[model samples]
Target: MWDMNFRRISGLLRRVDRLDHIDRLDAASHSAHEGGEGFSARHHRGVFELLPGTGLTLPRHAGVLRFGMSEREAQWAVATLADVRGTWVCRAGWAFTACYEGLELLAYGDCVDLGVSGFTAVHLHRRGPRLTEPSAVPVVLQDIDLFGYPANEVLAAVEPNLHPTVRLTPPPSPADHLSAVSLSAG
Candidate 1:
């Protein structure tokens, strides 16, 4: 199923390149005066930004868990966690987690490098003026039943640290499935 979905989306993206050719040409017209670069170059530039340095890294205490989970499951877990965490932090009346410069720089750098393929950003808020305060909310994991009885109840969980929450939302339908595939491929 995953393979089929991937193929379908890959085909669509390839089609997008063909379909957008005319638009690209039009965009290139405006750039004729600026050294005659084409639209594709402009598009690539718009999509990518270069960082001055290697960029920031997750804190020494921070860690990521990449276990024996399927790509879909990992995406779902991260997405759900970001959603719940955003709501929790918002209710607490604090700024979103991405406000930290270190985390922000790291996230943007990573996204630019990797194209933010399967990630979704969720805004988290908390009450108070102190930027360094810890969150009181606890991370939780829920079992998602992707199928019937004895379902693939993998332990999907979320961990909300000071970093901005970026996750992958579950593909709930055919359209979403296609979108997910297209995104992952890019």
Candidate 2:
């Protein structure tokens, strides 16, 4: 599983680099918006590319609060994610980001492609039903800050994801069991 997912992520890294070099993302949105590694068949549904120097933009999501963070906010968010279980730690265009993989699966496996650079984070969400309609809605975040962002912004982005922080605890390993047995024998 690890190797497979790693390969998948590695492929995504290369594709992201390819997309980054292009001049007009708008012109190349669909073509450059590469699908992910078998997460879904419709990976090219909608694409929102985040560029450098764009401070922060919150995509217009109906129920999901998808947005990038300031440096301080990003570091803090990392801490939050690090504590969570089943999170997808991503290397986006030379920066870092994480996703709640379990929650996504629970939510019918919605794909949220997030990219982070030294000073920016870009995201795209798939906003259509596979059986219902085959259309894509691209989301573009706005420039804002944690301090200036609307209330519940952080909450919305971080709340549904919080449950994972408790679910990723691994059970004791065989080595640990052996140590306990040896202690009892001694």
* Highest-scoring model, TM-score: 1
Residue 159, candidate 2: Cα error in Å is: 35
Q: How accurate is candidate 2 locally (lDDT)?
A: 0.26
Per-residue C-alpha lDDT of model 1 across residues 1-186, encoded as one tens digit per residue: 743464365442222243245357666775776766555532332111111111111222222312222334333433332321222221222112232211121121013344333222222223343322212221111211111111112112222321122222333332321111001112
Q: Over all chains combined, what TM-score does candidate 1 have?
A: 0.22
Clashing residue pairs, candidate 1?
Answer: 89-125, 92-127, 93-126, 94-126, 94-127
Residue 44 in candidate 2, Cα distance off native in Å: 28
Candidate 2 residue runs with Cα over 4 Å from true position: 1-55, 59-71, 75-117, 127-186
Error of 2 at 130 (Å): 3.2
- How far residue 110's Cα lies from its native spot in candidate 1, in Å, is 18
Residue-level lDDT tens digits of model 2 in 107-175:
111123432223333222222223121112222222111111122332244236433211111113311
